[model samples]
Target: MSRPFLKMNGLGNDFVVVEARSAPFRPSEAEARAIADRASGVGCDQIIGIEPSDRADAFMRIWNADGGEVSACGNATRCVGWLLLEASGRPSAAIETEAGLLQVARAEDAADGAKQVTVDMGVPGLDWRDIPLAEEMDTRGVELQVGPIDDPILHTPGCVSMGNPHVVFFVPDAEAAPVREVGPMIEHHLLFPERANVGFAQIKGRDRIRLRVWERGAGLTKACGTGACAALVAAARRGLTDRKATVEMDGGELVIEWRESDGHVLMTGPVAVEFTGTLKDRAA
Candidate 1:
């Protein structure tokens, strides 16, 4: 059977979405790798599968191009939201994933009639066990040395787990942080057992922050919505900024608000439709 797919981007973090709600299929690591191949298969940073869920929302299965199955993906979630909205005609929707349940709503551009989306990125997790560090440490500001760059501009980082682990360092300049130089090192640091996404965040104002990220499975992506939310949570935990702020990335900007009433991080951004195609065998 020919499977339908959609190519979408959320602030430039692109994804290839496959709908498998009825005829459920789970791809193996090798299969996922082949499907995500830019040259051979469908090119995408991540491959998202939408399946039926026992919960109120649909289930989201996220896979990296490398074929690794991850618990969560923020940008991909937006892509799923867009797809669900198109199919159901509803303005808002709920999606389930291994990480947890997420509430998503439509964000329409009044001027151009383009569709943007907002995701309720559930509460950020603090504490050593939550961040799941190798050893118990202060998550508010953990020390990570970058070899010779001991006096490195980006030293201590505030860590948080938004389903996925992230380490955010407040830097003088987002561009100044050795993103390429130290991103890999910090990601593979001994302290982080599951590895981590590294981020350098520069506070532009009380309500704005600029950031750069080196994702865990994927390298330097244009944008990482969860990373942005994590950055905001880290910043708030350190008293550097308020709960609600705007995070600017290479692709664009997302408005993030760590709701004080419930602690759920709300991420608002734009989602674009590049095109759609049908693949033979669908799951083959």
Candidate 2:
């Protein structure tokens, strides 16, 4: 069958969103992996499917290029928000993912012709147990030894859980951080029991930060919405930045606010339409 999809990107974190709300089909691990193959398939960092929901407005299922299912995907969630609003003619939306329910919206005069999407990423988890670390330690500055890299700049990490695990290392320069070399090590570190998306962040000012990320299972991505949100939370926990700040990534930027009143984190970014296509002879 020919399945219709929406090719979208939040910053440069690309995704292929399939509208499966009607028929309710779950794409298998093999199929998801095949569709995300850059050389042989549609090529995307992730594949998202919209299905019926029992608890929230709609259900969102995410799969990485490696065919592994993940709990949360911030970039793809914004893309799904845009698609749902366009279909329902609504400005506000609430969608469900493997992690939890999230609120989404279109910022006024947002970039990309008002295609900018703001997601209420909910509250961030600060406790080491919440981040699910192997042992109880200060999550605000967890010690991480990345083999023989032997750089004090990369040893300590501020861990936070935005439904998913993340380790944020505050560095002097976002560009100079060895994200390509040390990211994979920290991602699979023993401390992070469940593994994690690693982020290198530099606080440019009281309300600005620059970031780069190595996403779990997906390797290095152009951008990571959850990583950005986690970075903001980590910085706030370390008292390095204000609760509200703008996180700049290689692909683009996101306005992040960790509300003092409710402790919820709000991430605002743009989701762009790339193109759409179909897949045939695929499993049901």
Candidate 3:
């Protein structure tokens, strides 16, 4: 049977959302890759499946463009959260994922009627074992370097887990950082046993930063919500930024705050409904 789907984006980090609450819709890895291919199917950074959950309002399953199932996706969470809120006419919703449960709520809408969402991403993981590096090391400054022995363009990056592993490099200029070239290398580096999302951040101020991310399995995208959160945490750990900051990405901006009281990361951003349709030839 053809499946109805919604296309949504949060700060240009787009998703193809499939509701599987009643019927199971488990796409094979190859099928997911095909669906995410820009030239072949409905292109998106990730594919999200909404299923029933006893612990939360819904269960969100994430599949990257490469068809690999991952534990977390913050931008997609905001998109799905808005959908749930709109459908239930409620102000908040809880979504379960492989990573954990997320509490999402509707914020004030934009002047143009654009919906806004805030997700409680929970506490970030700072321990070396939590980031799950190949070996134990100081997460604040992991022993990784790029470039020549005497001089390296990128080195001693801070590590954090915003549901997924990430290593953040504080660069002088995010635009000048060689994201496309060095990102893949760091993603596949041996230090990160589970691979990792690579973020290049430039601190503009204590409350502002510029970021570019090389998402694992998804390459470079317009924005990465979790990456932004991880960036803020890493920056704070390194004393480069405050607990809260506005992260500017290629797509737009996201407001991320690491709540000091609860130690949870709150990400607030705008979500857009691009379009909706059905998959004519459903994957079996």
What would the per-residue lDDT of candidate 1 be over residues 1-284, giving only the tens digit for each residue? 77788889888888888878888767788877877777988777888888999894589999887888999889889889877887889999999988899989988563556578899989889988988899988999997755467465567799999899999988888878889888988889899999999999999988999999998887888999889999999999888999999999999888899999998999988888899987657454
How many angstroms is residue 212 displaced in model 3 relative to the true structure, after the best TM-score fit?
0.4
Model 3, 203-279: lDDT tens digits are: 99999999999999999999999999999999998899999999999988999999999999999999999999886
For all candidates, the clash counts are 0, 0, 0
Worst 10 residues of 2 by lDDT: 145-154
Full-model lDDT, candidate 2: 0.87
Q: Model 3, 31: alpha-carbon shift in Å?
A: 0.1
Instruction: Please write out the lDDT profile of model 2 over residues 205-276, one tens digit for every residue.
Output: 989999999999888888999999999988988899999999999898899999999998898888889997
lDDT of 3: 0.94
- Candidate 3: lDDT of 65? 96
Ranking by lDDT: 3, 2, 1
- Which portions of model 1 miss their true places by more than 4 Å? 108-113, 280-283
What is the C-alpha local distance difference test score of each model?
0.87, 0.87, 0.94
Off by over 4 Å in 3: 282-284
- Is candidate 1 or 3 superior in lDDT? 3
Taking all chains together, the TM-score of candidate 1 against the true structure is 0.94
